[model samples]
Target: MVLTLTTFLLTLLSIPLLQKLYTLFYNAFLHPLRTFPGPPYVWTDWYKCYNDVYLNRNWTDVLKELHEKYGDVVRVGANELHFSNPSVYNDLYSPTHRWDKDGALYRVFNQDESSFGYLTYREAKARKDILAPLFSHRATCEMQGIVKKHLDRMCEALGKREESSDMLFALRSFSLDCITTYCFAKDVHASSAEDFKHPLVEAMDAAVPAIRVLQYFNPWRKLVFGLPPWLAKLTDPNAGARVELQDMLLEQVKEFVEDPKRMEQTSNPTIYHRLLDPSNGPVPSLKSLHDEAMSLFFGGAESSGNVSMLGTWYILQNPSIESRLREELREAWPDLEDMPRLEDLEKLPYLTAVIKESLRLSPSVPVPLPRVVPPQGATLSNHPIPGGTIVGMSLRFVHQSEEIFPDPQTFNPDRWLGPDASSLNKWLVAFSKGPTNCIGQNLAMCELYMAFAALFRRFELVLDGTRSEDLTYSEGFLPFFNPRHMRAFCRPVEA
Candidate 1:
């Protein structure tokens, strides 16, 4: 009996060793990517799992060094190649390309069939087709009032704060309010909270660290996310928050269903209106509706808020930039008392340049967006990549390519100021490019422009003991700022 128990324990230990041996042998000698140039451990999944999930190393830095050493194309995983060339953006992401989202990697995020998680071409196309109108240029324009209200509240709240405030939390709270307003059809006043620590905002922030854990070992995602309330509260750190957020959103769906005419009656009808409209065909399932709303809330809040907070820090660091931006705003909107229109802000070249540079320097989604190579295979940077392999480019690495943008690490708005700015747009993958790119981009842009215009025009921002490296990110799926050090102090600009 003792021998039998000892044998079982030995077998358990040997299984993983045997599996690792098989993986290493297969990836190094037998895999189709065997010829790809990369670090020895790139052939092993353990390398990726350790760095991305365990250590949370900056892939942007990791991939950049690998590419510089091995040339533009470097193998990052057993079947993955990281491309640094800007010219291949279209080839990889354009609709003509057969490349699709890496199902295995993205599934862990559980986007719930939202646009980001759509694995199949047909499903994504159908969903995008349905929701496209809401994010159209016209729709974004129409939503300016909602965005402006929150921006106003953020500025007001900042003015009220006596001490330095964590801009990351402040901006994230504001963005959550904006997105929740759009999603639920009414503002929850999250930004107006005296301390700017809304429950949903707190929940979303709490969920980020857990994402890395689940993303690496995602077979447990269903079990954990599907946990009963009581069990989830005990086992999952974010489960309570997640439940609360979902319940809030689900209630909005209930509100829409009970009063169909509320879509017309409400000043700002929820996202559910268009989705649930009889003219739009079948209403989405409760889970899909909940999932879609939750996805938007997370995406919208994180992406735009990161841009706003980080951009604010960069602007504050440069007095000349602050002066020039304010001068541009004043020129564009001569009467400070009169609210500036979104169209007017969009036309300001210097302000536009500042926003563009900020995004380039610190894109919210800075990680490698992995897309699977088609079965037919393809060439990237003149190298023939085998089919069924994973290929991607880290936006952080791509945006920082010294070849594409001279002194790429430096934040210079002038790079986006001239006729050259048009060329720069091709490489600006912050919103990504092509059909699979961010759907909320137009709204995000509008928010950025308005927020920058209002904040810079109205207040003078100073970094309250925060260094550039304080905001220097360690990459997760999105850039992660050390929240403790992301503080900024604001003073209202004297008349």
Candidate 2:
């Protein structure tokens, strides 16, 4: 009787495993996604899909290749669809769409429940509404002096460098210091190695990549979070780094909260002050304020810095383009010390074209902005797409399309200048378009124009023993070129 009971229990245990296998087979052959063309294993295994993404180094390129093979719309994963058609933009990011955020990746990035970084769509929208004014044109204009001071300091720092340092690293520090000062009313001074050595900066950097990885293994995230802080540190260095960063931010917020008079004394408006007033509007918890501030600081800094580096790289590689840019700068501003005001930079047509061209060639955020399809379903390029599908447009592919940008490989800023400039501008979607566009664009542009104007005016940059075509890109959550590996020889130019 005992033997019979044991055998029966073992048989029962095998049933679920068999059922799972059967379901997998059924999905592979009979599911709706099965009808769509993709790699054969995409339907059967998630790991295989991830492997393809990793192997390709850039999943966007893989998506483009698949689209070419299968059609404009291809089932790239079990539930994910890749759309190459421009109309995909409308269906995915449109305000009217009922689709909710499907990617749980944000959850891993969240510092705590009270932080804005973790907040759902409803919360994010509410926060955006309250905070939008702070990043406005008027707001950015008010902050121009603050921006310029930091830029000037950065230029000084670069001038002092004995060896050719990565412009991205220097700019990253500058942007970080600038944003932190605005947000916290205290200078983090991330512009120098000594400043970056501060515990807070080190921790935040470590935590960011950790959170990205943790988001992938969603099943055990809560358990991961629940681990002792020390144990968590062992598992994810980011968690430890995050703890230090958060502690620093919290301390600053506490100081502000304790001294209401201190908050009132600000002549210049900041996002922190705007969010602190309950009657002014719905305010996120102080904790949320801190996280959001950090997010803005890091996001704004890293992206703007990378773009500056890439833009500089492209200009240096093409000497004619560099010379033309300098001529425009000279015409725009005769005196190098007399920095071009924000308004002055705006009127420089060639400079604007150079910025646009650089963004097209190397967007800082090249990854697809992933969005889920709504329940009502949608049409992409006249083809009906089912609801609940994951969809995104690859900016890397879209910007490089030969139809939109003729001779796409060539670095031609004039395509954005001259008579055809307006037509070319219409096709430019580097910062993205519509409601979801980058809020910090004005600030980024201000820094870009200022940096370019300052650097080119003062120094002539040349590639240091490295060919432009031979420079390799390093893959991160953001695409940053290997800065140290690629060097530039800078010769001081006579004013």
Candidate 3:
């Protein structure tokens, strides 16, 4: 009887192990992607996580090496294939292809209800359609004042700083304020914090790496993010600001939803106006509003700040680049008091080149935007990829390809100014392409222009011991810079 009972317990445990063994064998020898080449461990499910989370490697860098070894298409997981050839990028992300977003990669953000987090193109489109008007070029042009208001606030704060400011935090703070105010008519005042150490900014800084780790244990993400404000604060005291900001957004969303007439009282039209309007579609649930607010706020702040910070970092390394940028800004504006219109700013060839080069060199969403092949399968790079296979090609592959951009690592804006520069737009997939591209792109473009122009035109900038080493980053949903952040002195130019 004792022996029989022990066998039953052992059998229950071994069942899961046996299932894993069968999966390994099937994935290695009998699965549809069996012909694809990868490291033997790719047959196992946890290898990418091992490389990304456990071994602590930059996953994209690893993909570069693996592509070198195994050619353009490599099976990176049991059902995942990562493509390195830039040719496949256009094919996968083209407007004609409306494949669902790969759930495995996107679920990390835990924003399933937001436009970005919606899996199917149809679902994403519904949300994007409602949100689209607010991000249109016309709308962005009209809303440039909102961006400048926050920029002015940031510059004022910078003027008061007695020492070098944290450029990352400063830019992030500016972006946070812009997004919060622009989206909800609420000023987070992230830029108003002393020396740019806003708690919300700090919490975001703290949250990025944990987000990278959360990929491995997806279910744990719920546990981590679901923690109550007090419990989250108790668990990680720095989370107080993050939780506070989230709670504030939730309250605002709640207030708007419960009494949507409050949207009429806002200084500007908020997302709540469109989202809650019955004509556009059914109003998203309160929880979904909370999710969308967090998604847009964090994504807007992080991406804009990262691109601007990276551009400034590289410019400080190349004084010629900075000189040319300042010269163009000075010419375009003529007087510091009278700034160029967003349209005029877009027309400045050199400024446009600088911005394009910045976007190309440092893609904000550099991760492999994975897409699942449909049930009927698909053809890419002349290879017939199997149905339901999770396939992705990272923007890093497209942006850094030597064939497309010679000497891709160098910060040379001239690349975008060449005679054939008109043709390079297809290769520039920074905001991505297709039906589900970034919904906030026009707004982001507006923010980048304002941020970069202000950084160069309004101040005489100097790096404060921030070297190239400090800018190295590991890939998550976004790039997570390591060791330290970019710091600089922003002495106001005497107009």
lDDT of each: 0.78, 0.68, 0.87
From the highest lDDT down, the ranking of the candidates is: 3, 1, 2
Instruction: Pull out the clashing pairs in model 1.
Output: none
Candidate 1 lowest-lDDT run of ten: 472-481
Q: Give one digit per residue, the lDDT tens place, for model 2 in 181-287.
A: 66665566666664224444455444434443555566666786557767867876556755555567777677667775677776466666767777667656676
Steric clash pairs (candidate 3): none
Candidate 3 runs further than 4 Å off = none
RMSD of each: 2.8, 3.3, 1.3
Off by over 4 Å in 1: 1-23, 236-239, 254-262
Q: What is the per-residue lDDT of model 3 for residues 375-406, given as tens digits with 9 covering 90 to 100?
A: 99998877899899999988999899899999
How does model 2 fare in lDDT?
Answer: 0.68
Clashes of 2: 2
The best candidate by TM-score is: 3
